[model samples]
Target: MNIFEFIRDPSQIGPWFHQLLLSAGMQEWVANLIGDVIGVLLIVGAVLTSAIFLIWLERKIAARLQDRVGPNRAGPYGLLQTLADIVKLLTKEDVTPDGADRVSFNLAPALMVMQIIMVAAIIPISAGLIGANLSVGLLYFIAMSGIASIGALMAGWASNNKYALLGGFRVVAQLLSYEIPLAFSLLAAVIWTGTMATNNLAMQQGELLFGFIPGWNILVMPFAALIFFIATLAEGERAPFDLLEAESEIVAGPNIEYSGLKFAWFYLQFFVNSLLLACIFTTVFLGGWQGPFVDQFPLLGIVYFFVKSLLVLLALMWVRATYPRLRIDQMMTFCWKVLVPVTLVVVLIVAIGARITPDRSINAVIISGANIVALLVTLGIIGRSLRRDVQRRKAALPGRSTAQV
Candidate 1:
């Protein structure tokens, strides 16, 4: 393809590069290997570059929410602040604690970053544009994504600090607890679409529902979307659910002992993972790469995908800025008691709805209606429970009367 054609259909860039290598008299296997390496490099580069930008973006977002200026002195509107931080981190002395396990202490941060890259590999950026379009992409993502918890454990345990170890324990608890609802939420989407491939999930969402609304999973499975988003906030260790790194309690969490570039890896992984999860959420629910006229101009898909992902990321930032951190008990209780049960019900309802109809639009409408009713019921139950707790607290007060309570 020529430049203009490639511009219109960026998805073909991979194949085009492969062909270009072939035209240079390279062997087929060699060309394929080179192409794959280049693809991996590109994915890594994109992720790392985005992490730098997101760091600044998040700081600015938080500053705006808090009514303050953030990173203004480093560069124009603080655009260069993250770059300066990167330089400082690189120049800092690399210090592995005197009693630390050298191997695992060094390995943990790289592993943390590696897992995020692995999950990103299967994500479809646009039509036919993915590093590895595995058939069981969703399952692969889930398996690979869990490696972060292992990394956190490694960091905490290998550091030999009590607080770090506690942070590790919290990571295990928080990630494992939320993974259930996260998996169930994705299961709802799988049941509705009858596929677990990430690309297929996005492709299925390309059509228009009833010839008007975008056929995004979020529209039909709002409960699943809500559950998935909430579980994701906990999984990513954003505020409120950020018990893993509750600096107030655990100092700096799993990577507390890390310094210099070692610390930067964990720091980079935080922002990168948040963005990746938002991308995954967009792919599964918000219709990744599906936009108007995208068929005619495939490059627009990338724009649509990133715009949706950014909005999700911004929502995450807003939550981080707005809410106070939850107590460990409260976090766990919300997950096991609230998110898990609600997600299960959402999955069952979706399964029934999908099985009841062959037409997607019909199924969507039915499922959407069912989701609304389920939401109302869930809210009513939660409200009633909260009222009872308040009443009980009032009754237990020494000088409280029924009227005052």
Candidate 2:
């Protein structure tokens, strides 16, 4: 029994999928071990490559928005800037702050970086490209994000700095607040597609919506896409919601005391985390690489996935450039008061529509109309509140006398 025979004869490899290979030519354990090692290396390489590219792209985008050049000297147009930075950091000495807990501080960055890499492995980059196409892909992504928060808390606690502690608390709050609407929007997609695996959800949606157009989740559930994007931005701790790493306030936040490669680990985690959010956005809302021409030519699926994810990532950068940071109170209010109720209503409406229609597509006109109405009503209430505040401020000001006094 050779490797070929092992693959051909399924029964011989029942409990041990490679046992037949042992019987034929190669030892079963060796073959399995080799495969596992190869798989892990591939996953690590992919994750590292993505993290490097994303970091460079983010810096470039941020700089361009601010009318400054970013990292243009390290490599061609700073293409290899992140790599150069990594080398510089790696060569530097690791310095643990005297107040920091040595063990936990050393371990925190590894924990955060590892979990993100693990999550990255589960996302499908293209057809037949997934490391693990689990039934609970969406659930796994959420759970993995929760794990990253633990690392954040650990980093904050181990650093033994007040700023780090405060950053940790903020991150915990931020993650908890945004995770709700994020889950809700993804839940709508799950219900619509009838699968939790990202790849399957996208494929199921690739069919005709009303006998002609190939359906994307975005078209059927645009609001979900919008909510998911907002929540993901918050989750990624990007602008307007990036209180965790507010430089002027926290001075690098949880990794404040870190130096050398340890600091690099934290930086790497940030980029990796951004990529994870983009990947999830691609998975849940943008059809996970499924597109018009891609299905016809399977190779295009990979290109489609990267292109779509990059577009989403660039949009995130755009928001970071355009929007000011939300005050903590405003951030909280936006998540709970505005996003929560609206997403809840959206979910309910989607569920009802699904039950009633069964086979027909959801009425875009009805859904869009409802979204507009909700937006207008919320704006109207907010406008009224602002007007009353303005009036009160004006009334509180004293009238000027006849003279300059």
By lDDT, the best candidate is 1
Any idea how many clashes model 1 has?
0
Q: Flag regions of model 1 displaced more than 4 Å.
A: 400-405
lDDT of each: 0.91, 0.79
Clashes per candidate (backbone, < 3 Å): 0, 2
Q: Model 1: how far is 109 from its true place, Å?
A: 0.6
lDDT of 2 by residue, 30-142 (tens): 87776567668888888877778888888999999989998899768999888888888989988888888888898889888888888886777666567677889899888
- Where is the poorest 10-residue window by lDDT in model 2? 6-15
lDDT tens digits, residue span 195-272, model 1? 888888899998888899998999989989998999889888899899988988999799988989989999999998
For model 1, state the Cα shift of residue 311 in Å: 0.5
Please give the lDDT score for candidate 2.
0.79
